[model samples]
Target: MQLIDSRYIMASPEVVWAALLNPEVLKDCVPGCESMTGSAEDGFEAVVAQKVGPVSARFTGLVKLSDLDIGKGLTISGEGKGGPAGYAKGGAKVTLEPIEGGTRLSYEVEANVGGKIAQLGSRIIDSFAKKMADTFFERFQTAVEGPAEAEEGTDETQKKGWFKRLIS
Candidate 1:
């Protein structure tokens, strides 16, 4: 599978870069992430529990960053095992560009999987991948924006609930 996309973050490149490299931020944003550790210089380890259709697995992987240009770009590669579920390996090249009052982040990622997970079907895996990416970005956006603005921009249905509480 391959994914290529970009997002505009409401922060400076430095702030966005700092959040990207922070394990705590990633752990909070990554879907199904049970744990993540290490650093950009020493490589990072992650454990994630993911499910697709009727198949579920716990993946443990190590990711390394290379050719880093500090607050600009980097190359990432990693592989993970899902025990009896399967194994996956992937790489990505990410670039950050300063845009307007914020930062634009882009990445091109390619990955392959094998074992029982592969047998489940590519469509399922592809959908899961897209969903995971969406969830990650949404969480990252919320984290950077903070909770006050998040609540202010809540959907109408959600706003009604909060309005009732405020009035009560």
Candidate 2:
């Protein structure tokens, strides 16, 4: 499946980029993330638990970022194994463009799934995927956008993962 979407952040592009690469922020924003170990340099090993239709499973995966351009965005790719549930892998291209009030963050992801989950059909999988993406972006926007202003010049806008699409 392929998904593309965009959101406007209230913070500067630099702030958004930092949050995107931050494992802590990702762990909190990711839907089912349990733990993330590693950094942007070596990639992160993570565990995420999720439920799809009648299947619920814990997925272990590795996420890595490449082709990074500071204060912009990068390409993310990863794979996950969910035992009998299934396996998923995918890549995404994210870009940040400066807008009038903030940054326009856009992403395009293409993912492939196999095993029991894939057998459920694309319609089901696609619907679930879209929902997951919507939730993620909504939370991300809340985190980085802060309120109406940055108090004391501190942006507290509150903000997840590479294989997220794979699981959905």
Candidate 3:
């Protein structure tokens, strides 16, 4: 499947880029993430636990970051095995563009699933993926902008043209 989305973050590209590369931030923001241990240069081993439909499993996998352009974008690709449950593999291309208020973070994602998880059907998997994206970004935006700013300007952020045109 393929997915695309964009969100306006209330921070500089530099700050956002740093957050994207920070394993601590990623572990906190990403749903079902148990541990992401490694470096950007070498790659990371990730342990994630997630429930999709009727099955719940813990997946241990490797993630790699490449095709990097500093302060702009990068590619993230990984695959995980959930024992007999199934496996998932995907890659995302994320780009950051500076805007009037802050930065526009956009991503194009492609992913696939197999075995029992795939047996749950496409619609279920799609819904799960979208929810994960939204939740992840919500946490990430909150973390980058801080609780005070994130809470204070909800109405204003909605009014921004970039936001209005990008996601909805």
- The clash count of every prediction, one per candidate, is 0, 4, 0
lDDT for predicted candidate 1 compared with the true structure: 0.77
What's the distance in Å from true for residue 141, model 2? 1.6
Best by TM-score: 3
Tens digit of lDDT per residue, candidate 1, span 8-109? 765677776777676777788878899989997898899989886787899999978888889998887888899999987887787889999778988887
Q: For candidate 3, lDDT tens digit of each residue in 15-127?
A: 78887787777788879999999988888889999999999989999989999899999988889999999998887899999998789999888888898999999999988
Ten-residue stretch with the least lDDT total in model 3? 159-168
By lDDT, the candidates rank as 3, 2, 1
lDDT of each: 0.77, 0.78, 0.82
lDDT of 3 at 124: 95
lDDT, candidate 1, residue 156? 28
- Least accurate stretch of 10 residues (summed lDDT) in model 1? 157-166
> How high is each candidate's TM-score?
0.83, 0.84, 0.86
Model 2 CA deviation exceeding 4 Å by range: 147-168
